[model samples]
Target: MRTAIVGSVLLVAGAVAAVTGILPLSDLVELWDRVWPILLFVLAITVVTELAAAAGLFTVIAQHTARWGRGRAWTLWLLVALLATVSTIFLSLDTTAVLLTPVVVVLARHSGLDPLPFALTTVWLANTGSLLLPVSNLTNLLAQHAMGQPSPFEFAALMAAPAVVAIVVPLAVIFVLYRRSLLARYRTGEGVAVDDPVLFRWSAGVVAALVPLLVSGLPVWIPAVAAALVLGAVFLVRRRGVLRVGLLPWQLIVLASGLFLFIEALHAVGLGTVLAAVSGEGESPLALLRLAVTGMVGANAIDNLPAYLALEPSAESPLRLAALLIGVNAGPLITPWASLATLLWHQRLTSMGVEIRWGRYMLLGVVVAPLTVVLSTLALAAFA
Candidate 1:
């Protein structure tokens, strides 16, 4: 619903800008043509992730996670963090935010465990863990393309170290914060029931195939679309009745495309020039730090997509651009309004019977998010 409103607003605003001769229709068309792959990749990867989840893949993983924890809270936490981080990096943060959060929530409760640590792990990782892949976050896709299209491997190469630092810092932070709560664990008897073992195996196999294919540096959409089709075929053969049209990530696709159009419109009136000024020819560590701080604050203030769009034009080089990306990916954790993933995670948690104190969430984020943004950007500045 919000995506529709935002898309509609962008359409109207862009139309007005074009009519007033502030922007050319040709420019708009060119902009859309340049970034259209965002929609395709988002849809294809989302489909693949959703289909695999529907095939009971996530549930099976969650159950196995419980078994592996051996009634140890810290062990369960490490596993949960790993799961959320993996889901975020591979499937995009939204998949982890929307799909994995619920699974972890239920797993925590079913295992008679405190849920806050698990829940926080999911949401935190959903934001910070998205740095490692082109497909990991829509922001990364936009940043990757905006900076000039790099291959999948090249994109990951730049982020590989920062991504590690991003996850590691948060792991240490969360461990400190929740160490006491994490000490209790409950036995998950046997395992969560898996409904069709063969279908599960097939769906899991297709998902596993995605890692190599994406890292192959081929176009992400092609491999993602192929995987979705393969898993989708298995689902249809066995679980045909469960497929819903809503499984298509139309909102996300529209969100990505609409954000582009809106940002381009902003560029038409000289806003982009102002933003581009921030990127000057400074490549010093301090310059990177300042730029990242700007991005981090922008994301918390107006959300990361627009924030990235605003900051992107100023990123004078790939290195500084990569630095800005660290802020964009890791810095959005400070508020509910910071990223759509945080919002979605909040909504999911509330709906599933967890009462999140907004005040407290923000307070904790204030303490941790800036720290995360600084550490992550520093890692990028040093290693990337």
Candidate 2:
């Protein structure tokens, strides 16, 4: 994973530089000038989640969730699903993918339940559940900046109903798909043993503060940077020895740089006109559907973040731009390479010795992503 991220960063940087004569400086400059706060918000959330994970916060929550299941697989499924959704919304889907996936897998295995449904629930929710907040998915931030929305809260106002639709559609579908397997519950033995109760509470408390911050209509970076700093200080006082530069997420920084550079190069070569051609510029249902389908397929083929960046310039209307992000954010379920969250979910499953067949995966995704996009787009259309 690290290798791929680094390699992509290097390749995009080298290729764009080779072609553009100075590494897409104009695009980078423009991106930094316009959207640097989004980058900081992304990085801060990454750091905050990583730090919280390091403090064993996610593990504690996972175990408690399993315990809350009380030996009922269905309840366990609901709780785990809720946890995954919450993690994706608050900590970012990357955290849900990288941290929450393994925890749920462990919980399922410990309870002698089939891990597939729980795992799928986590992975699917990681992408689909991220529509609620601007910081929930990087694409949300991109949508905010690229669409030039006047108020950050506008994303929530317009997307809240669609976010609900995005989450509920998959929840219903996946439950039916996994219901047979979820029968016959077993108790998760003693749940997880948390090491530091004080730090755990502190971590959870500070992290919870992010909710109010995000909805406060303040800048996206303010609450996140504040929360991350508080947690970093806690770690410094309690476990200062464990502090390392690794938590800074340099790879993500590089990835951001490469994405901007790549987009810059594309713009330089006039890809915007092509993207604009496909972007639905009207308020009609057909135009909205086109935007949703196109965004989903493009995201699955090329990854959502870059796909959003590539096509974002073409989205002129508020409703169209929001719909585009809905597709990219909620509809990346078809392929493993569709979203970073899905990719991270795949890596987590593979490490846990679970493999999902491509056919079955695509089959489910084909059903889920479209309905998610359609219902959510309709909701957005109504809201808009």
Candidate 3:
């Protein structure tokens, strides 16, 4: 609701700016031209995941994962980390945040383990693990556009090194911070019963098929929309009551639209120049670090998407662009609003009765964000 209100205000402000010529009409059109496909992908993929969850697909997987853990908390934690990574890389960070957070939290509780470790793993990996593919993060989509539409494999290869570092660094920090919790053993719970077995089977099948198509070098929205429509039709037949306006992710669409316009308006007024000056110039390791740090600061201050847009012009070289990606995609771990995924993850956790103290979260993030960003950036400079 708060997000909707803020998005409404920003959307109105951007409209006013365009009407008054504070932001050029041509520029607005150009921005939409670039972003519409990305937004479409976001909406479609979100719907697909939401419908899948509603069909008990994620719960089934979580229970299976619990069984696979063999009663070791550490093993279960690692499995959840792997699941979160796979979800973030293939489905997008928002999917991991919105869908996987609850699954892992519930999985932890059902196993009689501390939910905090599993909860933190999902949210952290949702941001950091998102660096591997264009579909993993919205900023990655924008970067892919800037990079002339590289093949999904090509994009993944370029980011593979840093993406590994980003995932590992967070996992290492998590293991150390929650070593006691993770080292304990727990009893495996029984599998969750599917209320609609046919719906679950179809939804699971659609998701399995959709995952490969997402990375098949086609525009991502094609597969996402197809999967969403397939699941929508299944739900309509098997569980019409679950199909509602709420599944559309209207707030996110509105928020992203408003953000793109609002940020473009700021850029039109010379935010770009200021950001470029701050980000500096060069593909040197130090220069890349500077740009990455600048992006990290901007992301923590505002949000990752806006930070990426603000600093993108300065990242002309491929290496520098990788660095910027490292910062914006892997660096937004501190504040709740640092990335939309974090916000969504927090919301999911709260709804499931998990309470996280913001001060401790911030303190932990302050330590982990810099380490992850710096190590990941250096890994890019060294490897990519």
Candidate 4:
């Protein structure tokens, strides 16, 4: 809680500094000019996705799997994670959190499993899965636009090997550690009970909202506009009472936009050029590896999106970009603050009274993240 407060304070202070000229508005304006469309697009998608989740799509999915106990719970959670990943591929990690976290919390309680693992899996895989598509994560989208890199399908194919390794290995580790509890829960026949018809209706509505986004290659704005209309109609039908369904995290949306503007200010001060120069002197695979490692470490210190924005312009090759992206996503596994998804997961866990200490989370990250990074980098270097 203290960490969240401090982080919030820092975010606000940074935004103030940027706006007041202490951080330089010229750079902020330059980036805003160039990236504002994408920013709006992301924000719109975030809003719409949140609304869809409020409609209870995850609850509906979880209910269908309630009969199988632990296996059912784990599988459902895994599917939720995958759905979050898919959502992130199109919307962004933030949107995935908005859409999935509430459902995950309910499902975790219903299944009698620790929410931490599910939360971690969602955030971690959301990062990895988003890497497979250009629209999946902010960093990937920026990289694609800035560099004219591979298409989403192309990138996903290239990342297929790493994605398998990442998901399978982590699940194995998680299962090994928690097998007893999982098995016990399975034997007990514990499962989620469907209590609310309203939730089911909402879930159906959310799925309806997402179909256009998924089936067609329509611009994000189309989905955004559709969601707004649908949500608005739902609101009018319920006479503003339905707003409680929680379609969006308005605070987070504002916070992300503000941070982006703040980082843009830093970028304008020639930080990109400085970093680019540092990156240009060497092409050693080890050096590239080190950069990726450092990026992960730095993401914990700062945040991943900002760190990516700062480092991305310096990336000289597709290989370097891949390393940086994989490293940044993997790095967040080590620290709660390393990725927005982690932070959101932490918040969700704490809200549910699930206690996972920072030390333990870091311990897991130290073990898993480096291995994932190395494997992902090798895949990228080989294929990209």
The per-model lDDT (C-alpha) reads 0.78, 0.76, 0.86, 0.62
Model 1 agreement with the true structure over 326-374: per-residue lDDT tens digits: 8888888886767777866776676569987989888878887888878
Candidate closest to the true structure, highest TM-score: 3
Sort the candidates on TM-score, descending order. Answer: 3, 1, 4, 2
The digit string of per-residue lDDT tens for model 4 on 15-117 reads: 7777677676566566666555544554555555444444555655555444433455556555665666667666666556555666666666666666666
Give the winner by lDDT.
Answer: 3
The TM-scores of all predictions, comma-separated, are 0.81, 0.77, 0.90, 0.78
- Residue 65 of model 4 has an lDDT of 47
By summed lDDT, the worst window of 10 consecutive residues in model 3 runs over 343-352
Candidate 2: lDDT of 260?
Answer: 52
Task: Show where candidate 3 strays beyond 4 Å.
Answer: 144-158, 350-353, 357-360
What's the TM for model 1? 0.81
Those runs of model 2 whose alpha carbons end farther than 4 Å from true positions after fitting are: 1-6, 9-15, 22-24, 33-55, 86-92, 95-99, 132-135, 141-157, 196-257, 344-363, 379-384
lDDT of 3 by residue, 268-324 (tens): 999989999999999878988999999999898778988898898999966788899
What 10-residue stretch in candidate 4 is worst by lDDT?
185-194
RMSD of each: 3.7, 4.1, 2.4, 4.1
lDDT of 2 by residue, 314-342 (tens): 67777888788887988889976677567
Error of 2 at 100 (Å): 3.9
Model 3 TM-score relative to the real fold: 0.90
